[model samples]
Target: MGTFRDAMSYPLLRVGLIMLILALLISIAGFYRVNKTYSASGTLGEGMHYLGDDKFENEYLYHNRTLVLYSSNANLSLLQGAEMTNYTLVDREITLHPEERPVIYVFNGSVNYTYNATAVDYPYAVYSLFAFVLMLVGVVMAFLGYTQFLRDVKEGKK
Candidate 1:
């Protein structure tokens, strides 16, 4: 149809297609990086972002120049302004309990702290979520552009 033909030249449709491609690339890269785990061993000083009530909920740690999250049910009072020496950080999947969900483990030469994810993989989930949103926006934009172009063609404007 002439309407469909005219719609092919819609500028917004082209922009939406480009965004869709970019979103796909981002999602693929995010997935690849999120699955990969890592480990590090060093001395960590102090904990930030403490979320707990009586019992320990979660906290952020700076390990090896990377910000990571460590969580536990018990009150890890030692993490407050205390330097954790000879600490070993192990990512999920290769942890002692491989069957459990994705998480990171921190062994402070004495106590063990479990984290939701590693610094390398944690932020990728947010990136992937953003990519998904981009994909949705692209789809909507492409559809709107095509329809608008078709409407213009119907009115003999194209």
Candidate 2:
């Protein structure tokens, strides 16, 4: 307790503590966001109905300027002139049926559009993983700093 108190008095230790706290908070928030997005996206996907027509309009919304489209059917195609850029297609095995496995189309686009299909899970998952890693690093660093401070205190007292 004395060592901890002395460590807390140091400016560097204080800054490290603040950083650790912030990292923990960010990681928690990121995880919560990811969980919420997954639940919401699952609900949306379950409720989604297949459009009989090839042409459809949909909207994707997120804090960042990006959109994701998910569909079980591989026969679908995005119409031209949607102004989408850097599009990438990823195969996601969320469904039991191989043929109905979800294909995710990710790209940067405005949230103000209608689409036939859309997904909101992938981006949040990615963000959550990143934050989790950051939190792990911060925790390790804080622990090491605390131990080092304790060692220094013991040496000085000797």
Best by TM-score: 1
* Model 2 agreement with the true structure over 81-132: per-residue lDDT tens digits: 4432232223422222111213333233211112223224333444556656
lDDT digits (tens) for residues 88-124 of candidate 1: 3333111232211222233332233333323233445
Native-referenced Cα lDDT, model 1: 0.48
Clashing pairs in 1: none
User: What stretches of model 2 exceed 4 Å from their correct place?
Assistant: 1-3, 10-15, 31-123
Q: In model 1, where do residues sit more than 4 Å from their true spots? A: 3-8, 34-123
Model 2: weakest 10-residue lDDT segment is 35-44
Determine which window of 10 residues in candidate 1 has minimal summed lDDT. Answer: 51-60
The TM-scores of all predictions, comma-separated, are: 0.41, 0.37
